[model samples]
Target: MSEQHTYRVIVRGVWDGLSEDSRARLLAEVDDHGLTAMTFSEEGSLTYDRALKHFSWRFTVVSDAADGDEMAAAIAEDRAASALAALGHGFRDLRSTVTDLDTMKINYKGGRR
Candidate 1:
């Protein structure tokens, strides 16, 4: 059986200092359907301290159909429009920085899976 895969979603250019209410609403809207998306990667935890101006989301999905990076990029595109609306600046550019899943070292820590 194929293993589950994790996809990291990193977005930049969202203005910092969001109000608690705004942040919560944004979080809910973007993350409520976590089951539809992949799981938050434990590997992505470190991304936060360095990702202040940006935000990260993740999805862990098990699918043999779609290629990982392609799936990740598709999620990025699907969310970009709504995310821009939520941020409400209209002019703030979004910069996505997901490590291509194809090159990700999934099982390299000790040995191949």
Candidate 2:
């Protein structure tokens, strides 16, 4: 049987100067990317120390049998990139993590050691 996998996209640094329209644009971008589920926190709630603060927007992308094996990974990646691009300012950086079904651990730049 084919193996299962999970993909996640974490977006940070949504500039405080962003306008209401821009925020909406970002949400649309996430949806356009084809993520399984997406959610954003209210603005002004996130702090520098805790970037994932109450205000920060967190989007979690899941790739499983429901997404169909042929196109889950590609869709997730595309969505992540698009969402990052939408944050014109206060957009610090975008981090992506992937994991296998058998091993729920992530393999990042650290070499998965």
lDDT value, candidate 2, whole model: 0.41
Clashing pairs in 1: 38-59, 38-60, 39-59, 39-60
lDDT of 1 by residue, 89-109 (tens): 232455655564544767547
What does the lDDT come to for candidate 1?
A: 0.47
**Model 2: what TM-score?**
0.30
What stretches of model 2 exceed 4 Å from their correct place? 16-77, 81-92, 97-101, 105-113
Could you give candidate 2's per-residue lDDT for residues 26-80 as a string of tens digits? 4555434333334332111122222222123343444565554334434544554
TM-score for all predictions? 0.36, 0.30
Residue 112 local lDDT, model 1: 62
Once fitted onto the true fold, the runs of candidate 1 whose alpha carbons sit more than 4 angstroms away are 1-4, 14-65, 100-103, 106-113
**Candidate maximizing TM-score:** 1
